[model samples]
Target: MRQPRPRPRLLPLTPRRLPLTAALAALGGLAGCISGDGGTPPDTAPPAVHLQQPAEGQELAQPALQVVGFIRDDRGVQRAEYSLNGGPPQPVALTPNPDGSRSFGFQAALAEGANRLRVVAYDAAGNAGAAERRVTYRPPPPLPAAVEIDPSAFAGGWWDRYGPTYDSNPALADHGVSHTHLYGNDAGYVEYAFTLDRPPGTALATLRARLSSNFPGWSGPADGESDVTVYLNGKEQGTRRVMADNGSGGEYRFALAPADFVAGRNVLRLEVKSGSAKKNGLAIYYRALLPGFVDTPISIAFSAQPLPSFTLEPLYAPGAAAFAIAQGADALYYFKINRQNGFDVPAQNFESTGFTGSILGTDLNRVKVTFRKDLSSGDRLAVVVQAGPQAPLGEHAFWAEGRGGGVGSSPAAVNLRVVACSSGCR
Candidate 1:
């Protein structure tokens, strides 16, 4: 190591020494400021706040309350507080949601009446902002009674109108009677006619009729087809086709104008045609515009035995059973069997039973049964196998009668059937 010329004696400046130099420079600046050499003061901005949900004077029906807002500046939000109806403030988390909106929700039991909600937001910089809204809270409304009817009372020429009975049977007793008759010849062609007692101020909207089975007893090879034409006040309204072989029996559902119904009476006429034997009957049901129109028919469903080919006897065991009287349309009949004779079934008077039923007028083929009570065991029921129409020129009287007694349930028994009349048989 040859002795290099003595390097100029130099001292290293340590990190501590550098800081000291900076401190001296700061002091010099202060001295200069005292000499009036300082720059202008810095500019400061305040944080901002806004509210999103529950506009002013809004109504809130739900339980959970969500308070949302936004704040400007990176001075991250610190805490959020909310109050309902001037109550004590509740602290809420300042968590940012994935939707870029900050929200705070609390399980608050607000006062019953009018309520005022206030939300206050604070940031890390101690900047605070607030918003408020007025809201009303109310309870829900009560429920309404359900729409219903009875099918058993639908039998006979007319259904007796009664009051709303909370009893298992909701239908009122026969207030008026609806007359329906089927008259046909061996040719399988039938005609049906009926008269309805239209109550004062009542508006009839729909007329419905259901058949127990398709046209029967016809020998023609062509599938029997039934035609239904509706006449309002003897004026033609509309007509529809009913097919029996396709499994669609007969149903005629048509809309009636208010003028079509008179304050005292309204008449309806139906015509039927079959390819073979005249084997079918109809059960009619009507609907009015007014609620609780006691005299109007609500539902009319019917049952029939296997006919034409299958001589299967009508199942009459007292119980709930479904029967397909027409294609795509089936009727339910509830039978109650008993040892005593409490039920009186005469040649007429089928409306006393408590069965809720319905009939569609489109083809008069389908019947629907809704029972309030079940039927007793071993009950015998007479169901119509087939029926058809006849000429209006004859004087025919058709009726049904029966008698029975037993330990009957609330609804008793419900049965549907088709009535047929040959020459001079109506």
Candidate 2:
């Protein structure tokens, strides 16, 4: 390679010096312009905020919310506050750090829909720094249609010594033990585990229980009373004091909230207190009832007025039979007509297969007829049965098969005795 053009002689570099006045000015600028008295400068900049919780655009299910974050400044942070949905400011809890920073925390109740959350922090110099976030809150979904936990579903449970004994058979000693009946002077509880399709909210549920007591068949001088406490999972639901004064073993109903139940498996507990009876304390046999799919007759009466459930009397009707039926929920019920003894349903009065106008069929006890709409909310319907001229006159029994909302209830027995009409029948 050609002589790299005589390399310029390398020389050692030397630092450049500035005037005394210029040096002092540069130092003052770095110090943020110290006061004339040589004191620290005021903090003009606001606090720097870093939100750590409820990130922006977050969606929440519950109204109760907890906010957390940190704030920093060159100077020490003084205080902090937060506001939700443009509401009044609320104080925040601050934790101090060695580096002139503060960690803040607070709680806020969010409204139903979109919520605006703003957190502001102040430094010793009264400078404020703010951070804002938008979050949306939604309410929980509704409860399922219905649920029913039978007696056999409950297995053995724990027994606590008295304050509330978790007993297995609280009513085993009543002498005629059937179902989960509880009676005695010792306080005890029984828990039933059940599964739900959805979370139990505030929807209405019922507890069908019989509260009655006697001194082993009329031995005690006075009727006894028992106190019972109901619980869903671990939460207290309600309490009741049932009296053993009714001889018929009257059923008492207790209203329950679905919210006490969870989606999957859940526990229902009944805590009974010791009573002051010679032999029995509080005799209670309870069953947990949830509104699901029910298809059964709540009540049936021959007259226009509604009657109590399971009410029956000797039936003697001529030509036609008229009655009323009541159900607990809305449904479409199918009535099955059956012959009693050797009676036969008139072949001319019903269809064999397809139900065209109201779905009527006849085949002795195998006949199915009467598709009627049943209203819920404790409503009843009137049903009239007219025997054809060719039909035999005797006793008959019928039942209703209810179906609605993709679910069904067991059929209920409704019996009737048809007498011959002197003037002939339809």
Per-residue CA lDDT of candidate 2, range 278-323, in tens?
2234444433222331222111011111111221223232434443
Best-matching candidate per lDDT: 2
The per-prediction tally of clashing pairs is 72, 11
Error of 2 at 88 (Å): 1.5
CA shift at 3, candidate 1, in angstroms?
A: 57
RMSD of each: 27.3, 31.0
Clash count for candidate 1 is 72
Tell me the spans in candidate 1 whose CA falls farther than 4 Å from its real position: 1-47, 61-66, 97-112, 147-426
- Badly placed stretches (over 4 Å) of model 2 are 1-42, 145-426
lDDT (tens digit, per residue) of candidate 1 on 260-330: 54534344544332342342322222332224432333322211111111111223333323233454433
lDDT of 2 at 13: 42
Give the distance in Å from residue 152's predicted Cα in candidate 1 to where it truly belongs. Answer: 7.4
